[model samples]
Target chain A: MTWEIFNAIGTIAFAISGAIVALEEEYDILGVYVLGMVTAFGGGAIRNLLIGVPVSALWDQGLLFLMAILVITVVFLFPLRALKQWKRWGTFTDAIGLSTFAILGALYAAEMNHPLSATIIAALLTGSGGGMLRDVLAGRKPVVLREDIYGLWAMLAGLLIGVGAVNQTWGLYVLFVAIVILRMMTVHYKWRLPHRTIKQQEDVSV
Target chain B: MTWEIFNAIGTIAFAISGAIVALEEEYDILGVYVLGMVTAFGGGAIRNLLIGVPVSALWDQGLLFLMAILVITVVFLFPLRALKQWKRWGTFTDAIGLSTFAILGALYAAEMNHPLSATIIAALLTGSGGGMLRDVLAGRKPVVLREDIYGLWAMLAGLLIGVGAVNQTWGLYVLFVAIVILRMMTVHYKWRLPHRTIKQQEDVSV
Candidate 1:
């Protein structure tokens, strides 16, 4: 029950986020839908692929797909001024989505008896993977890899779950809320990971 | 038997192409290996995920993994002058890889009794998926979507197989050679698809 609720929230938030990005990129209607779907499901698809789940199983979530599409379509049709305001709300919802997805992923991996490392990886990928794909498809740097302290919070959630500190239902909810707060605080504070770039003469062509 | 041969050729070429791109992006040694592995295996992984194969089945190809890693290591260690020379040859090898991987994907889908459209999609994804992933991870536009006549040839190969025009082993061999030639010719001639971009005042930030 908790899992289903979390999944629905994450899916809707991600769908809206994806639609926003697609519109920002000036993608057509079809591109908007495709990008929206990718953002909503890309993380779970990648997590399933890595965790030995049948990727086609994603199709089983018929209601989730409908809900996500509805959210995306609504976002796409909203007026420009409304969208601008929604962007402010978007960060909070995005934090909610990220936290729920990460904890859920770690929970799934832990239930499957995967090692702590695998659980951590699952959490990180599930939390950030959709956003990463969204950014990449939009032709931008993956925010998780280079930007703020985003992935670290996901890792921390995974670690807590893996170490058996958050095995209860209320514990998961507590972790979820804590992570959302941490992510939003980091965003507000503009927290960033340590940066490094190798300075060298480089060919920019691929 | 034929599939194994084609897989080997494709893996080596893609590994080299991936290493070249990673080096061009100025990534460290670890990035080169990760990108190389992703370039070599990402297509098959994506295809398998879409077509209901167990994604983890990719791990069964231990020999192929070793071969891909070895090729990447060699490319990394090559002197700058030698690397430049390899770039000239890289196009030809890449064409070969694309042709082989595309045909193999189509064959797999066809043998499974999938629809013609699915077969074509499989071929296109298998041929171009790795390169797309590499480019995205390196923070560039997917070359397959924007650049050349790359995906068309894969679709063509898939169409021929789907329609039963290339069922025989010899027919497949002929088709492979024809695709390689066509792809190389297009690269030589610089063919491009029709494109239109919507001009608008758009938010570039995602």
Candidate 2:
């Protein structure tokens, strides 16, 4: 039950985020819908693939699909004035989505007997894969690769779960809440990961 | 025997293309190898997922992985003066890779008794999927979405194979050759699909 609720929330949150990006990119109605759906489901699909789940398993989630579509439609119909606050709210909602998905992905992999590395990879991909696809299709760099401490939290969640530190249902809930809070704090504090630059003759510039 | 040969050729071609793009993007050596491997194997991995093949199947292709890595190393080690010729021969090599992969993907899907649409999707994805992933990772727009008549040929190959018009080994070879020629001609002649533009207030410009 917790999984279902968190998954639904994540789906809606991601769909809205994707729609916002599509509109910003000047995509037409078709593009908007495509991007929205991809964002909502891309992460799960990728996670499933990584863990050996059949891609056709995605078709079984009728309710999640409906929820995502409904959310996308409502986002598109929302007033432009109300959307001015999206910058503030978007980060919060995205954090919620990322945390929920990360936990879910880690739990799923742990249940499937995947190793610790695979579980962590599943968490990171499930948390950020859709957003990366959204950015790529919109012709932008993926934020996770260069942004604040985003994927790291997902990895942490996966590690905790894989190590059996958070096994029960209540423990999962706690982990989920903790991750959301951590993600929000990271964003609010503007935490960033260290980056390295190569010092060489920059010849090819795309 | 044919499948092995075609698959190897496609892998080398795509790895080279991806390495070139990474070089052009000014990525480090690590980035070049990552992009090359993703380009060489990403599509097949995706196709396998869609057809219910275990993702672990990817790890089984040790020879292919070695081949792709070797190709990427060679591409990077090639002389700077000779690298200029990449712009000249890259298109031809990419066309060949695209055609071979498209046919191979379609044939794999059809053999699995997938629906016609799935076969077509598999073909298109297998042919262009790696390149799309490479471009996305490199932080650029996927060329298949905007390039001249690229994905259409893959779809055509899938359609023919799915419909049983190209069933025999000889027929498959003919179809593969035909697709390569068509792709080359489209590139040489600069054929492009008509694009529609939406008139809207550009809000989010990446």
Cα displacement (Å) at residue B17, model 1: 14
lDDT of 1 by residue, A1-206 (tens): 99999988988888887777776666655456556777888888878877877775675676787788788778767767777666467788888889988998899899989999999999999998998888888786777888779899999999999999999989999999999999989888978788887675586547
Candidate 2 on A65-170: residue-level lDDT in tens? Answer: 7788788877777777666567767777788789888988898899999999989999999999988888888897788887888899999999999899999989
**What are the DockQ scores of the candidates, in order?**
0.13, 0.14
- TM-score leader: 2
lDDT of 2 at B80: 96
Residues B1-206 of candidate 1 have per-residue lDDT tens digits of: 88899899998888889888999999999999999999999988888886788778999999999999999999999989988887558888889889988998899888878777667767877898888888888887766655667878888998899888999988888999999999988888987653323222333222
Residue A48 lDDT in candidate 1: 81
Q: Against the true structure, whose lDDT is highest?
A: 1
